[model samples]
Target: MINIANTKTSSTEQKNTPMAFLELAFRPFFLCASFFSIISLLLWGAMLNGSFTADVYGGALWWHKHEMLFGFVSAIIVGFLLTAVQNWTGVRSLNGKGLLGLFILWLLGRVLFLMPVNLSPWFIILVDITFLPLAAAALAYPIIQVKLWRNLMFIPILLIMTLINIVMHYSIVSQSPQLMNNASTAMVLLVTLIMTIMGGRVFPMFTANGTQTPRVNAVGWLEKVVIITTLVALIISFNIIDLPTEFKAGIYFIAAVAHAARAFRWKVWVTLKTPLVWSLHFSYWCIAIGLLLFGVAELSATVSQSQAVHLLTVGAMGTMILSMISRVSLGHTGRAIVASKLMTFAFITIILSTIFRVFGSYFLTDYSQVINTAIVFWVIAYGCFVYIYLPILTKAKPGY
Candidate 1:
């Protein structure tokens, strides 16, 4: 005889089993983002050191740049938006099978790009560029259901990113190296704009919440100025070749001052006691300093553009992503948002990595040695993340 009550109970338990890890967007996506960052950096460092000298899709250097911009960073963006939309709308996004499918699409994109298979251009295009739009679709239902018009801004940003990815793919497929470089730079600037917007919202809140501060000091006019000037700078950055050198430097210089002035209002100094808090502040500081140096590099011969970009990438994006994932994974998993001692050291190493990559490479004569040192710190920073957070990500929630 079939027991109906027992069968229902068994099914309920099955749904709440270890599979609950995938029930939220953060679990699988954060794990994948961290792991992919580690593997990609390993490959990039090895290539720089003459350890492996083979191209993946278009060329070795392009492959590295493309994956970091489109692959790893995109994964983080999707994870964050998916999880965030659910919270914003009080509606459920993808879970279980739907979430798994989205993740598989991302994984397949990585594979199709790196694997030594001569797939058709259209096939690669279908695989590489489909993930972000699907993610947007997953969010659109909830966002539109509640008439969240203001939040619709992210949809266009995601679509632009998708278009940029497509342009990058076309460049590679058509064998246009110059187009690929321009698209890659555009993608970098686009991601930076996204970071700037999100950081402005969260960093202040996190600082106030973490430090038990009563106020978040922000001026409305200054905030609007920051956004407007940042947009102007991004437009010029994308069209940098057409613009004169002095104009580019002037735009970037204004952006640097605006960013630094805004960051000063965020109460960064009070949060220095907490690793999780200060890391966010320090990363934003990098963006401001990097922009200033980026403008200076355009005018002078000593500080290279490549060096300035590394500061933004390694110092700003890399550290901010690392710190954010650490905090998000813990809080979402129902754990206390506190950093372990080892994790604090991990944070320090990443900051050091950025300093070495930017300043050390600029000041020191031996660039190779500077790069090698930076890579070691980068690995250790992410390596600690995998070590500390793997179990947190893979297992079911502590209470569950």
Candidate 2:
């Protein structure tokens, strides 16, 4: 659905940029998202150890969950979409002062959430909910101008995420922890759906190009089944409909099977030699496994929902974000797409972090230690990214 082939910036469009970093949405958003993720994770670890105390709005736990989704992940999603829409429609997206204003708007939401000064809950909600809609508008304009109807699906998804964010804030005002948890789970499922759709588009293409293999053709029926089942699972996760546990479990299992089968057609085995390609395959498998485990959690007494969620969060989302940003940054910036040695190690560490976060509770007696260890791996993984990519992100692309 994305026109990966049409990524070159026209000279006329390039003339509008005042600075390199602010020239494209991906530059600032990716940099900020990576740094914020590390800071958020460290604060989370400190919160677990009882060392960090901040009078963050919505309490610490709620801030951690909400910020990771609406704060960190949302930034990356906006960045990727805005940048990709340019390629899809051959229309320039937000850039220069306009892009900076949007970035500042997003930053204000994150800052207001953690500021020690007491603030009206309504004011914060207004600031936070405004980013996505504006971003959706920025994204929608280009597609509509070019009549790229197929790419328009992302606008509604962004608006829906904004709606979920509103519900999350309302849960805090209502003092309903259950509602907050449900909203968070729904947000996670919604992100998984985004990943599912995007991965289906790019994984086979990336794998084939990286490995010099023939691209696998998608079966129309199977593709439809995958999207339909994922939508059902997402609806169930929202807890809007009162579905039985068995019925919910059945939907999850069907989604899981559909994802796994769809992934198999992507030629995952051949990607192992290429970290950039295989990391994506590994992350997609995490989604499939996470969905299956989610079904098991619903049906079985032993498996907790939290464990499955960590797999999707730390494994699927974290790894995939790192992989995508790494590759996208290089390609867009006019560099070769090869992963550096340190970057490759970063990829491996993130995968380890996911494994520990998801399975460590089952094998280890001390849950705190499991979480701490997972945090350490995560820090190392993302730390490598910041260290290696800082210069690449800040400096102008060679000969630009």
Candidate number achieving the greatest lDDT relative to the actual structure: 2
Cα lDDT of candidate 1 equals: 0.80
**TM-score of each predicted structure versus truth:** 0.93, 0.97
Assess the local accuracy of residue 207 in candidate 1 as a C-alpha lDDT between 0 and 100: 87
Report every candidate's CA lDDT: 0.80, 0.89
lDDT of 2 at 315: 95
Q: Could you give candidate 2's per-residue lDDT for residues 1-400 as a string of tens digits?
A: 7534325665655666777788789889998888898888888888888998888889988999999999999999999998898888877888989999999999999889888376887888899999999999999999999898988999999999999999999998899999999999999999999999888888889999999999999999999988999888888888877889999999889999999999998978898889999999999999999999999999996878998888999999999999999998888888889899999999999988998899998788998888888988988988998888788777666776
Q: Give each model's clash number.
A: 0, 0
The candidate that wins on TM-score is: 2
Q: Which digits, one per residue and each the tens of the lDDT, describe model 1 over residues 1-400?
A: 0000100113444365448667677778888877887788778778888997665776677888888888888888888777777777766667778889999999888877776466875776798889999988887888899988778788889899998888888887788877787787777767778778888777877887789886686788888877776777667765545888898898788888989998898878899889999999998888788888879998998888777788788898899989988988887677788999999999999998998988896578987788778878998999999899889888766655
